[model samples]
Target: MSVDTAAIRRIAKLARIHVEEEALPGLAAEFNGILQWIEQLQQVDTSGVEPMAGGGATALRWRADEVTDGAQAERVLANAPEREGEYFSVPKVVE
Candidate 1:
């Protein structure tokens, strides 16, 4: 895959990148090299490979789901500057 100066210029225009006229040739060569490397990668065979989430074979650790009361409402409200009944009181914002 050979990337010409015209193609590089078009890519720069589409990407909103400003490339100087002198740098276009260098940019084109670099792009051509990248495309050639990608083409080489496409020739590899991976027909029987299974997709993996991580490099290690370890399983994820998990805990059992259970419900419990957070029984310290009065203790928590004691630190509040303004608390009403069983809740924190704040200035109402809406009319």
Candidate 2:
């Protein structure tokens, strides 16, 4: 893949990066080198390689799924200036 200065300019615009006009040629050449390296990587043989998880062969530990309330509502509502039943109450500011 050939990366010309015009393509580099377009890429910079899309990525919201500021590139000096004189630096476009250098950036284009760098991008072309990267694309060529990626193309080379695509030609490698991976048919015999097995997919592996990032955590390796070990099974991950998992905790039991349980449901229960935190049961601290009274403690949480202790600092309220005004509360109606179980909720905080605020002055009405609109009709």
Score residue 13 of candidate 2 by CA lDDT.
98
Per-residue lDDT tens digits for candidate 1, residues 3-56, read 899999999999999999999999988998899999999998967875577545
TM-score of each: 0.55, 0.57
lDDT of 2: 0.88
Q: What TM-score, to 2 decimals, does candidate 1 have? A: 0.55
Off by over 4 Å in 2: 54-62, 67-95
lDDT of 2 by residue, 12-52 (tens): 99999999999999998899999999999999998878668
Each model's lDDT comes to: 0.88, 0.88
Identify the candidate with maximal TM-score: 2
TM match of model 2 to true structure? 0.57
Superposed Cα deviation of residue 24, candidate 1 (Å): 0.6
